[model samples]
Target chain A: MHALIQGIILGVLTAGVYALMASGQTLIFGIMKVVNLAQGAMVILGAYLSYQLFTSFGIDPLLAIPITTVAMFILGVAVQLLFLRPLKAEDRSELSLLVTFAVALLLEGIMSVTWKTSVRSINTGYANSSWTVFGYQITLVRLWAFLLSIAALLVLYLLLNRTRFGRAIRATVQNPESARLLGVESSRVSALGFGLGAATAAAAGSVYGLLYPFNSGSHYDLISRLLSIVLLGGLGSIGGAVVGALIVSTSSAVVASAISPSWSEMTFFVILLLVLLIRPQGLFGTTARGAI
Target chain B: MQLHNRLRTTSSLVAGLAAIALVITGCASKGGGGGSTAATSGANGSPLIIGASVSLTGDFSDSGKAVQRGYQLWADTVNAKGGILGRKVQIKIVDDASSPTQVVTNYQNLINKDHVDLTFGPFSTLLTIPASQVAKRYGYAFLAPAGGGPDVFKQNLTNFFFVQPAPTTQSGDVFANWILSLSPADRPKTAAYAELDDPFSAPIAENIRTKFEAAGIQTVYKQVYPSETQDLSPVMAAIAAKHPDVIIGGTQSVDAYAQIKALVQLKYSPKFMFQSNGANSPLEYPNKVGAGNTTGVMSSADWFPGSKASGSDAFTADYTKKFGGTAQQVDDNSAEAYATGQLIEAVAAKTGKLDNATIISSLHSGSWPTVLGDLSWGANGAPTGEFNLVQWQGGKLLPVYPSGVSQAAPVFPKPNWGG
Candidate 1:
């Protein structure tokens, strides 16, 4: 029983970070109708940047989040402008897969040359430090990571729903032609939306580096999971991503605590299959636009 | 009219027969030359191309990178002294990306495109499988830095050699023997856990089980978990119920580390020993979790710092001076890679020719002195399998067994809760 309770706490904390990462993926899909396969690579790039800053300049990874996010935002804008923006709008939805895959490969190559493909963990003093609350031990780093993820998600929510740019983005997603006539430049909105998506990755990346050991190729595995979460959440919905992350994380954790640890990873896939079988789209996904 | 007819018929028959002969010869050459290019390259007098297919990216990336670094370090040292036998040696490296398909592709590319004379590869067992197949098919000499399965040797690839002892051989026979030698009162009940379907992990887990039984410590339970498992609750609970004297884990460093953390949180006090692979990581286990938390845990590996016996001190000094830190983890692969560099130089110096067959034969016939000891190959051109057992003592790795190599007494009564 204690194990189960502790597992739930762990699951919730883990879900927060996954939610942040999945939100970025969903946002990109929402704005451009492109899956943005390079989202994971961008996250890894963010981690590497944070690692460099922490190691070389004595900056804390958590503290470096703002700098990393802004840098990644610019990179995201550049990628959309240079690589993604040029594609014909009619052909974009499918062609973006190949383009994004190429971008992932390019990022991998660059990281390989710079870091030499070695596994690195950003070891902060508080990485393993934990505290016991109600007979459940909580790692300080994990707790911090969860809180930071939530804070980032909240910021993203405000940016998307409460601002002029947010309204333009919504208009484009709902009606591309109508949004353009209302003095909304669809291209500029997409570029900013892509930047925002990448900014989320940087925020999550800082936390991710604290929680896991990573290398250049880590993005391959990470991207797959993020895709799963975004798809489950109804592709374009940020709220859907949060709900999807919580469900996946909680189930896996509960299984790990209740049943065999070995079955936990498989359980997520099983649940995903079962859910998709019943709904076909996702929990919150609409067959027409929001789901893949 | 009769002379003209005779002349035309004779010339036509001669031309037809000559064309038939040429076509037959061409067909025969193309069919017979399929694998001969690979064989001929193996026998060629050109600089021996030692192909290395290694994990340049992923979890095992650092180990693979370190192995490559050591290999190149050996090569550079040899070349600077003088070209190996007046012939410059070249090493071709292919990054396998730690995937099986990529490993096969890289191995084929190395043999087909690079036309490598000899090959060394594949730091892990999974990647080694396909890489070795390519060597066996091409008839090129292949040496693996860190692949040895009991069944792998059973395949009997004539040109393929494993330079390290089998996972079972190293952990099962030697380490277990030492544990069993401990007095009956000190012996504890044991249980083992491993990641199922992992070739290197399963054998070690099985070997530990057998050895623990021999020591009269009955195993209450044994379990295999999926590779993707992040939590170890079920197995830990089953083992906890058994209340075994010790728990042996056959897993990677990350999994082992995570399990230990979980176990500590659950407050289960079983004497823990991680399997050989996870135990050998250069990273300090005790430092990862404070010394007090990691005490009484035992692990064995190819190299340990506490062993003043044999080449331990020299390797530590040389590696520290060059790499700016102590050589915490020096496995058979690392030492062999260093030795390979030296051996190639030695052979090249004596022969002065870079013939593939000559280098392979020379390496097979002679014994090479290495930091680990005399690494002499048997008739099969594989290292005479030898290993050293080490235990973690107060956050320091010290050689404990193989009585001849031990520098410190085994920390018996393993400092417990109050220590």
Candidate 2:
């Protein structure tokens, strides 16, 4: 019973970062109707940027988040402008997959050349510090990461719910043709939405670097898990992504602690399978367009 | 109309002739001087080619580059010493990218396409196991410097020779015996294991569990984590609940760093903690996990910094000078690679030839002195060498086991996490 509770606590903390990362993925899909395959690569790029700032400039990883996020936002906009904008609207969804994959490979190649594929981590003074409350250990980095993720998500929610730009984004997602007729400028919304998605990834990447050692190739694993979360949550649904992350992480941790470590990886998929069977559109997901 | 037709035919003939000429020249340039039958004998004035496929860019790139450097150092040193058997040594290396299938393909190209006279083993048992089979199929002698899996020995290949110690299974025996050497009262009573789920690491973990249990240590917890696991909190929590005295496992450098971080975060410090591949790495281990945090953690290694073995000091100095790293960076992997080269050179000099059969026979019959130590092959071409237990003390790996080879005494009951 104690182990189960401990696993739950660890899982919830871990799920916060996964939720942040998956939220970016789903957000990109929401606006563009094209899955950004390079989301994981962008996250890793953000991590490398954070790692650089922390190591060379002596900036704290958490403090460097804004810098990385802004930089990644610019890069994401450029990518959408240069790569995604040129694709034929009819074939954009199918071709964007390949284009984004190419983008991922390009990023991976650049990172490998710069960092030499060695696994690196950002270790702050408080990286390994933790608090014990009621016989439960809560790591300082995880707690900070969770709080920061919540804050970032809240900001995202506000941006999507309360702002004129958010309404434009929603209009674009709902009816691209109608939105353009109404002077929404769907292309601009897409670029900004992509940038916002990348910005979220950057924020999550900073927390990830502080938590785990990563290399250029780690994106492969990260992307697979991210895709699973996005799929399990209904495509383009932010709330659904968060819930998917929670369920996936908690179940994996609980299984690892209770049954065995070998079964932990399979547990997520088992839950995904069960969830998909019961609710084809996911728990909070809706079939309606722009329902995010 | 007739004149135009004649002109077209003449142009077509000229273009076809030029294309044929280009093809011939391309093949000629690629063939490397008509494939001289006396290439191995140096009769054609060609260097003796020793080919290898290493993980140049991938997860294992660090170790792969080190092994390649070792081979290069040997080649340069021998060429400076007027060559081996009156011929300069030429090493041909291809990148396998740390894939088993690519390893096989690289060996095939090296042997069947490039026609190298001899082949050295790739880094890691995962690559070496498959790469050695390619050598056997091609009837070439393969000398593996880094592979120590028992599965390779089980194959019973006649031409394959491993320079490292026999199988990682023996590592468990060595570690168990070392633990027993301590006073009974001071020895660990309970143990835990968290091993990487991989071909090479899993065997070592299982063997350690078996041997530790045989030695009367109660194994309170044991689990295998995925190779790419970036977090170990669940495993650490489960182990901590059991209150084990000793925690040992097989982990790569990244996994080790995660494990250490988790241990620190959970504030669950075992009396003794050790990781196989993680601790052996000179740079990544201490660099990732702060040296202070890693103090007193034990790791097994095949070579140490200071040794009185033949050519050990000189090889270490030359490797450091040539590779542009500290002397401490030259660990068993590089040392064994250099020693493997030396062994091959010695065999060539003694036999007065570079033939595969002669080299294999020489290796099977004689014990050769190397920078690593005196190496002798046992049944199934497994080399006999020492696996030393080393502990991190004040930011250096000090040999601490088997009193005869130890440079320092074992530090028992590791200090508190931050102490």
Candidate 3:
């Protein structure tokens, strides 16, 4: 029972970070129907940026998110403008796959050349610090990262629900031609939406660097997980992505704690397979257009 | 016109694929004369081409690149020394990106298309079998730095030679031997083991278990997780709950850092901890896990920076001069590569020829002096030396096993994590 509870606590803390990473992937798909294959690369780039700032200037990764997010936002806009925007509407979704993959490869090459192939981990003063709650250990860094994820999600919710620009984004996602006729400037929305997606990746990347040992090539592992989460969440639903993350994290954690870690890795892919069989649209996903 | 346009696009696509292939093939020095096999001299006075496919961009990219550095340094050193047999040594390395299929294709290309005089092995046991098969078909020696999985020896390919000190499975036996050497009271009463489901890592855990259990060290927990298993905290928690006195981490790559960090997070500090392949490289290990946290953590290896082996000093000097790191930064993989080069050089000098049949016959008989001590191979191409055990003490990865080579004794009931 104690082990079960501990796994739950761990799963919930880890889910927050996964939700944040998957949210950006879903957001890009919702806005432009162009799956951002390079979302993982953007997140890794953000990690490298945070790693640089922390190593060079002694800035905490949590504090460097603002700078990383802004810089990543500009890079994301440029990617959308330079590579993605050129595709004709009829071929945009199909062709964006190839273009974004190319961008990912390009980013991977650039990162590899800059930071040779080696494993790097960011160790803060509290890297091993933890707190005991009711005979269960909860790491301090994980707790802070979880809280930060919640705050970031709340801000994302506000941006999508409360602002005029948010409404424009939703309108463009729903009916591009209608939104353009209604003076929404769909192209601008698409660019900003892509940038916002990359910004979210940057936020999540900072937390990821704190949590894992990584290198320039680490994005390959992340892309599969992000894609699975997005698919299990029904393509472009943010709330569904969170729930998918919860299922993915908790099922594997509980099984690992209860059974064996060897079997735990299979639990998530199994659950995903079963979930897709039962409800192709996912838990919170709708058959209609996506919303944040 | 439409049919002509479609035909033109298809041709362009084919031409683009060829260009990409050319880029991969020409990764090392380029514009060479016609290729030659090991049995023949370079055509029209071309350099002796040694071709390889390394994992440059994928899962094995880290170790693959280290292997590449070893091969590159050896080639450069050989060329500087008046070119082996009056011909320059030029190495052509292509990126296999860590794919087993890609490695096979690369070996085929190296032998058939490029006709490289000699072929080197790729990164893992998973790759070496397929790669050595290609080398065997073409009758060229496949001297490799890594890929010492027992399965490679099972194939019994005469063309293949593993340059490391010993087979990887025996690494665990070395650690177990050290534990048995300690006084019964000093040794841990309870031990736990964890490993990745890797051809290289899984056997180490099993081998250690056999030795430890026979010595009456009760195993409280063990888990063999897949290589892609995420969220290691739960596994660490499971081990923590068992509260073993010692931990045997059978990890090959950087996952050792992950396992240690997870234990730290769980607040579970064992009496002693050791790993199979991790913590050997000072450049990476201490940085990933804090230098303080690494104290007293034992790791087994095939080589270290402090070795007084033949030509080791020169290898270190050349590595530092070329790579611009300190002498200590000279990695074990690069040493293995240079040693393979030494083995080939010995074969060439002894036989007064570079034929594959002579090379294979020579390797089976005589000992080859290398940076990792004078190495001798059995008929199966497995080396005769044993893996050395090292520990982090006083901010250094000092040799702690084989009394002849050990600089320091291992700390028992190792001080608390980062204490």
Candidate 4:
């Protein structure tokens, strides 16, 4: 029972970072209707960036988040402008998948050349520090990462709810034609939305590097989990991504602690399958229209 | 009509160029007679061609590169000694990208298409398995440096020869024997396992489990995490909850770091911890985690720098001088690769012929000496060698067991994490 509770706490804290990463995938899907398969690659790129910053300049990975996010945001905007922008509107959704995959491969190639596919982790002074509360160990890095994720998510919420650009983004999601008719530039919104998505991934990646050892190939696993979370939460919904990440991570942790580690990976797909069976539209998805 | 005609000509021209490009790429990928040209034979005194597909770009790149360097070091030294049997040795390495399918394709290209005189094995056991099959089909001798799993020996391939200690099962027994050597008061009462779920690692963990249980240690927590697992917290948490005195498992370098990090964060230090692959090397363990973090960790190794084995110091020095790394960086994988080359040279010198069958037969029958110790292939094509019990002491991996090879006294009840 103690193990179960501890696993749940670990899972919940881990879910915060996963939520941050999945939120980006959800946002990109919401705004552009493109799955943005490169989301994981962007996260890896962010990690590498953080690794470099920490190693080269002795900057803490947590502090490197904003710089990496800005850098990834620009890269995301450029990617959208260069690749997604060229596709015809009729073929955009299907072709974007292939194009994003190409971008992912491109990033992977660059990272392989640069980092040589060796696994690296960021070790800060406080990386291994933890506190015990009520007989439970709370790692300092995970606690900080969770707090940072919540703070970032809150900032994202404010940006969406209390800003003009946020209003334009919501408008575009609801009705692209109506939003365009009202003088909101859909292309600009998409570029910004993609950038925002990438920014979220960057933040998550910084936290991820602190938590896990990573390499260029890590994105493959990250993207799969992100896709599962986004799909389980209901495509393009931030709230759904958060809930989905929490459920997936918590269940996996609980199963790992209670049953066995072998069954932990299966728990994700099993829950995904059950959710899909019961609610075809997803946990928070609408049958009539996609919600963000 | 003009526009349509113009489009037709342009499309035809594009198709023609595409076909030509495809043809060129096809020829380029076959490695194009390079091996064949080199293998023109003992008669013409051309270089002896040896081909291998190494993982240069993927998950196994670190081990792959080390193996490649080992081969190069041997090749350079042999060439400097006026070549192997009066012919310069040429090694052709293609990047397998850590994929078994690619390894098979690379070997096929080397044997069927390139027609190299001999072949060397790839990095890991999983890769070496399929690669040996390809060599067997082509009737070429494959000397494996990095791969030695019980599964490979189980294949019973005549052409496949492994130079490492007999598989995880035997190594597990060696480790168990070492553990059993501990005095009753000093021995661990409880044990736990956290292993990587891969072909090479999983069996080692299983063997360790069987041996640990046989020794009457209370088997507490045993879990196998997926390969490339980034998060080990939950697994560590579960293991920590059990409060086992000894922890043993299979982990790669990166995973070892993760495990150490998790152990520290959880404030759960088992009295003793042993990781199979990565913990044996200082570059993989103590250097990967900060120095203080790995103080009391133990690992099983095929080769240790502390060995009094002949040529060990010379090989280590040459490797360091050539590879531009510390002497400690030259571990079992690199030493085995160098040994593979030395064995080939020895076989060539003794047989006085580069014939594949002659070399294969010689390897099967003879006891050859190399930098990594004596090599004698058993009926199963696995070499009989010792697996040294090594531990991290003062940031260096010192051999602690097998009395003859002991570099330092085994530090038990490893210092508190970060103390």
Pick the DockQ winner.
2
lDDT of 1 by residue, A165-227 (tens): 888888887777888998999999999988989999998988888777677888988898888
Q: TM-score of A-chain in each prediction?
A: 0.96, 0.98, 0.97, 0.98
Query: Which digits, one per residue and each the tens of the lDDT, describe model 4 over residues B289-394?
Result: 7778878888877677756665677778888898776776665677878878888887877867666677677888868877655777876687776677888888
**Candidate 2 lDDT over residue span B107-171, tens digit each:** 76676568787899988766777777767755678898876666668768888888754555455
lDDT of 2 by residue, A54-148 (tens): 99999998999989999999999999999999999999989999999999999999998998786789988888899999988999999999999
Candidate 2 chain B lowest-lDDT run of ten? B1-10
What TM-score does chain B alone reach in each candidate, compared with the true chain B? 0.74, 0.82, 0.83, 0.81
**Ten-residue stretch with the least lDDT total in model 1 chain B:** B1-10
Q: What lDDT score goes with residue B98 in model 3?
A: 75
- Which CAPRI quality tier does the interface of model 2 achieve? medium
lDDT of 4 at B385: 63
lDDT tens digits, residues B79-137, model 3?
88977777788889999987666776787687667777888878776667667766765
lDDT values for all models: 0.67, 0.80, 0.80, 0.80
Identify the superior model by TM-score, candidate 1 or candidate 2.
2
Q: Enumerate the candidates' DockQ scores in order.
A: 0.21, 0.60, 0.53, 0.52
Top-TM-score structure, candidate number:
2
- Extract clashing residue pairs from model 4: none
Q: After superposing candidate 1, which stretches have Cα over 4 Å from the reference?
A: A289-292, B1-146, B156-169, B190-192, B213-245, B260-269, B283-297, B305-332, B338-386, B412-419
